[model samples]
Target: MDFMDFKNKQTTVVVVGAGFAGAAIAFHLTRLGMERVFVLEREEFPGMHASGKNAAMIRQVVPNKLISDLARGGAAFLRNLPLDWPVETKFEQNGSFFLASKKDSEKIQQDGAYAKQCGTLTEWWPIERITEFIPIIEGSPASGGLWCPTDGVIDIHSLMQGYLKSAAMNGAELKFSNAVKNIVVHHGRVCAVQTESEEIPADIVINAAGAWATELGRLAGSLNVPLTPCSRHLFVTKPLDWIKSKWPIVWDITQEIYFRPESGGLLLCPCDEEVQDPNITKNDPLILNMLAEKISHFYPRLSDLPILRSWSGLRTLTPDRQFLVGWDPCVEGFFWLAGLGGHGVTVSYSVGLLAASLIVEGNKSQSTNQFSPSRFR
Candidate 1:
């Protein structure tokens, strides 16, 4: 079809998924004056999966340099969003504390330095001094801890809705309960996508399906990107008198456990990871066995607290532990914005901005460009 004829027949783009990655991409696209952006969500509402189910942390102390920059950019945006933002999302400015074993102290220090170069404040605290702020914390596995005051918590549901609402205000079409079943590629380019209800033609397709991203790629005849959806559980404790609500989120890198103040109680995680299919997560009560053991070993103070509630969520990750962004090398018009690992909430804004930039300007900087999906291809 000719340009004008094609314009009359289909949308300029179809973004499959309405989680943070998809919603943010669609939001940025509309902000950049791209009209007719279509967002397809499989759930009854946006962010019902990993986007809303995450721990809602905005931490910058990531494992890689590339994602650290994205976290810096995204954290800044979350800290001070423009007044034009569609909704007022709450961002708690409490800092994050990362502990490391004696052997890993130097390495954690190096990561902190890299984060500082990316623009976040990093402070190395001796194990004895880490108690100055968190008086109740006790663990000798870590010699010291790194403190990033800018790392904070956010109301993820509100943030996700804000992006989508802003996009909708700018005329982006959002269709929930519209799961993509098939992708049509003809003459080496995308032509249409079929849902359970209808087949819609599109000029391009973006795979922001979160844990289901690899499945979407397969449907599009794209290469099997190395992405795994792993399950992790979050546990909350009943109210406690000694637990202050203002305590910063604390993570132990060596032990792979974390806890933070939540609702006059505490939120804890053993950092359990189990690879599984991308579907509704089934609660593995057995994982709590490991959680109990970690608490006894690393954080003995709260081993007696009664469990209030628990839920599981999936985080998709690439084997190299970096995100996979940009266009699929083998697919003519397929783009990827998945495998964000644990930094999804922290680097969300930057992820969307970079994805939209790749779609519109067809270019990116080397730092942000390192996450291209072609790396796996």
Candidate 2:
């Protein structure tokens, strides 16, 4: 197969997911004037898997420096959507509190310092201040907490739709309910992809299949990127009188538990990570016991609340927990945009922008080069 010019507007590019990654990438590619972009989603609707699931929090001051940068950029995009943005979405800038025990206080504070150095405003609030801010957790076990003023929750569904809709408006064809059955690679180069209904020729193929990314890569005979899809459960409580909707997200980094106001009550997670098959998430009752134990030890004040509902979602991860983005070294014109872990909602925009830049310009800067998929090979 002859390699077509990436700059050619006639080049057909197929993205293999309609989740955050694929939607954002298609949006950016179309925005860059790419005319023949096609997005194939297995589900009838977008964000049916990991993109629609999980907590919709925007946590910027994470331990990973590279991911924190992307989170910051993504948060900025959500905070101020473009004037031509096709949809309206809400971003609750209620901020967040990352609680750490005495043993982990130094590391959490150091992470806060690093975030500050990276231009994300952060504050180390003493135990007294934190208790006063949230009276319910007055006797919390955390010695102090890292306060990130910009982190908050977002309307993930709307945000995802905006990206996809904007892309479709710019000549990108989004084909839902179309699963790629075969990625025809002839002589180490991808020529076309056969879907459930028809086959489409492609000059480029992007693997943004979320949890099924590894399976999709196998179909393309691409690199064996160490991607794992881990399932985690989230529980929401029934309405409580004391719960305030404006309260910020509180996370116990040491205990690995987090909670925020939801539906006149609170949403909680135990930060459980269990390896599971792609797109098949089942809630484990044992994890609820673990959540109860963690709540009893870390947040005893609200542990007695009644559980209203629970659901599990997949978070695809690499070995190192950083994002996987770049062209495949094994197959020509095949890109990797998976392995976002659980920060897809917070870092989708920047991740997509970075992937688009690498695909378009084929240049890697010092910062951008860290996420290259070739490193794993």
User: TM-score for each prediction?
Assistant: 0.95, 0.97
Note the Cα lDDT for every prediction shown. 0.86, 0.90
- Per-residue lDDT tens digits for candidate 1, residues 84-179, read 898889999799889988877788899999988767899999888987779767754678899999888899988998999999999899999999
List candidate 2 stretches off by more than 4 Å.
Answer: 1-4, 363-368
Position 289, candidate 1: lDDT: 89
Per-residue error for 62 in candidate 2, Å, reads 1.3
Q: After superposition, how far is residue 288 of candidate 1 from its true place, in Å?
A: 0.9
